[model samples]
Structure formats: structure tokens, C-alpha cells
Target: MRWTWIDRFVRLEPGRRATAVKNLSWAEDYFADHFPGYPVMPAPLILEGLAQTGGILVGHVHQYRKNVILAKMTARFHAEAHPGQQITYTVELLDLNEAGARVRGTATVHDKLLAEADIMFAHVGPEQLPAELADPQFVFSGELAHLLRQAESVISASSSSPPSAVTS
Candidate 1:
């Protein structure tokens, strides 16, 4: 099973920045073993979710040309996240090249910063691989469509106006 940590794309600003969310649920398998009775989300896993958000944004910048693999990270965790928290990861593009991309991001629960990191993504293999292999999103169009729908909803909702009260 291919695990997608982020649930929705709250914002995507092309080459500038992006924001995505992960809704932690009690039903997750890892929670049962993570801390026994006190289920706390692992720090590395939280960072992975953030990386996925950044990776997707970076892929958009490249139009899915090269593989975006995590090269390095300097992540600091400030708070523990429980099962019911919705973690929002906001990533800003620092730099990009054929070599890879550099992104800085922060994961937050509402207004509280849970974690922050500067992550680097690098191209994994030789220069000759086909785009299908180099950039993997194309291989799973059906699954990505569902994710895209969730993401698009967030983007559309942000630009939409609230319902007006009709006093008739």
C-alpha cells in the first residue's frame, strides 16, 4: 500500500509556496504500537508528511520531470500531536535545479507550531531514466485523481466567498 500522509492541499502557489494538511486519526495502525496506551505520533513520520507536501509542490515546479527524494532535513519538534489533531504543513520553495529542490516548511496545529524543517530533495538516479520512472506520480493516475480532488477542494474553498444571509 502506498501511503499518502497528507490529506488535502490547503494552498499551492506554484513555485512560491504550498500548504497541505494531515488529519491524524485514532484508527491508524501505528498508533496501537507507537506508545501503547499513550499514542503519540512519531517525529519522523510527522516530518515525512511534511516532506510529501514539499515534494508535491516541488514536483509541480518541475512539471514532474525528475524524482524528488528527500536528501536532508533539519527538523525540530516543538509539541506532541495526538490522534485528533489536524496538522498543517506549509512549505516554501527555497531553490530548485536539475540536481533537486530545497524547501523550508513548518507543521502546525491551528496556531501552534508543532515542527519546522528545512528539507532538501535530490534526484535519485542516472539522467537517462524515462519520465514515468523518474517522476512517479504519472504511474498512479487513478489514485492521484482522488487526492487531487481533495486538494482542489481546499484551493477552491479558499477563493470562494462565504454564504450570505438572506433576510427576506
Candidate 2:
């Protein structure tokens, strides 16, 4: 499915990090039977969201090349995210190399921490996985690429803006 989760939640923050937003709503498909009256976003899915966000960051750091897969994660869920909440997931790169990279991230609803994780990934060549899995060009092209490029452009312009001169 090309992991539409990334497009649905993630926003690249140019040279700093990537921030993803997940809007929980009663209309979500999973809410039908997910605790019926007391529903919450599943912890596993929240981890998946973190992984996707960090994966996108690693992918961009590699200039959209290489197949990157989550190798490890130490994640904790501190609070339940309920319907009508806007969860902001942010990932910051801790280190990067030819092999892969490490990222630290947190998911929050307003000031309440929903989850946090330290994610690690392995960067492999296109031959390391299924043709579909390894080809990022195919995965990110079309609409997703257009949106990401737009985000990237906006980040670039924002970064290039000069600091205002202070009154002497």
C-alpha cells in the first residue's frame, strides 16, 4: 500500500526534524469495536506511527535512496489518545551513517505525552528486500512526492529567511 500512513501523518521539518500529526476521530474505522464506549488509539499503532515518521526522516536524510527498515524501538505509551485529539509526533535525528541512523521522538496531545520512542533503522540497497519494498521512487512518487516536495520547499524558504535586524 506504499505505507500511506506516512502521507497521512507525517510532515518533514527540513534541516531539523519531521513532525507527524494524527487526528483521532470517532469516524475512524478501528473505533467500531476498539473498546466501543471507551476507545483509544492502540499502542501498537502509535508505535507504528512513530516508526513511519522516523523512517521518513531517515529516507530523506539518505536523499531518498536506499531501503530503510526499522530495526529496533524502545517505545513507551504514557497516556491514551482519544477521539478529537490531535497528536503531534516529532522525530529528531540523533546520528546517521552509511549503515543507518538513530532517531528519538515523542507523540503528544497538547502538553500531555502520549508516547515516546528511540528508533533505529538499517539502510540497505534496493536488492535487500522485495522489489516493491526497496523502491522508494515508486513508493513516494505521484501525490506523496508532490506533497513532500511542497513541504520541503516551504521549509527551505523558511530557513533561508534572514533574521530581522534589531533596532540600534
Candidate 3:
């Protein structure tokens, strides 16, 4: 089963950038095992959320025709995110090409930086992998597809509305 780390997309500018949000709560399963009294959001999960945001941005550039995989990432954490906080992941496309794409991402809560990451995503064609692993829909299927649709809906709704009616 695939778990979606991000809750929803707040903004998506295809080929340029993407912004997504994940709200942490004490009800999460990880919080139970992470710490009994002081539950902190796991660092890796935070990175995963950022990667998902960046990966969606990269895949959107190719119209989700290629499977975008996280190749490498370097991240630094400035503060711990707690259960009641909302994490906003903003990723900017640094570079893009046929082989791969690179993005710079930041996780923030209430305008304060919690973490930052530089992520690289590689695009792999069906022919480049084993048959079992080469499902064309592998990357953009299921939950991930749902997130993309939500992003498109937000983008479409915003574009059709007046500037004064739009609020971020």
C-alpha cells in the first residue's frame, strides 16, 4: 500500500513550482511509536512530503508520461514540527531535462522555516526497467493521481475566478 504524505495541493504552477500542505495530528500512527508524551513528526516523512510535492511538479512538466523517481536529496532541519502544526511544502524547479529534474524545497510552519531540501528526480521510461516494474501508470496512479487532480482543480478554479476573489 502507498501512503500519501501530503494532504493537498495549495498551488501548482506546471514546470515552475508547487505548494502543498500536510497537517499533523496526534492521531497519526507514527506519533504513537515515535514518542509517548512528546510526539514529533518524523524527519523522513517530512522529506517524503517535500519529495512528493517536487515529484508531482516534475512529472506535470512531461504530462505524467514519464515515471519520476527521487534520485537524491539533501536536507537540513531547523526545527521540529509538532502535531498541531501545519507544514507547507513549497518546491521550486531548479532544472529540468529529458533525463531528470531538480528542485529546491522548503517546509515551513507559520512562515517559519522548519526544513529545507534539494531534491533530484530521475525520469525513467518503461523500456529502462524490468517488465514487472515498468508499469506506465506506476508513478501517477492511485493516491498520487488523486493529488494531481486536486491540484488541477485548484488551478482551474483560481484561473476562472477574479483576482479579488482569490485568496491564498
Instruction: Specify the poorest-scoring 10-residue window by lDDT in model 1.
Output: 159-168
TM-scores, one per candidate: 0.79, 0.78, 0.89
Expressed as tens digits, the lDDT of each residue in 1-168 for candidate 1 is 757788889787666678998999989998999999999999998999899888877766545555667889999989999999999999988887667778999999999999999999886554445666744444225455576555545543342332232101
Instruction: Give the 10-residue window scoring lowest on summed lDDT in candidate 3.
Output: 159-168
- Model 2 spans > 4 angstroms off: 1-3, 6-11, 130-147, 153-168
| TM-score of predicted structure 3 | 0.89
lDDT of each: 0.77, 0.70, 0.86
Q: How many residue pairs clash per model? A: 0, 0, 0
Better of 1 and 2 by lDDT: 1
lDDT of prediction 3 = 0.86
Give the poorly placed runs of model 3, Cα more than 4 Å off.
156-168
Task: Please report how far candidate 3 places residue 102 from its true position, in Å.
Answer: 0.3
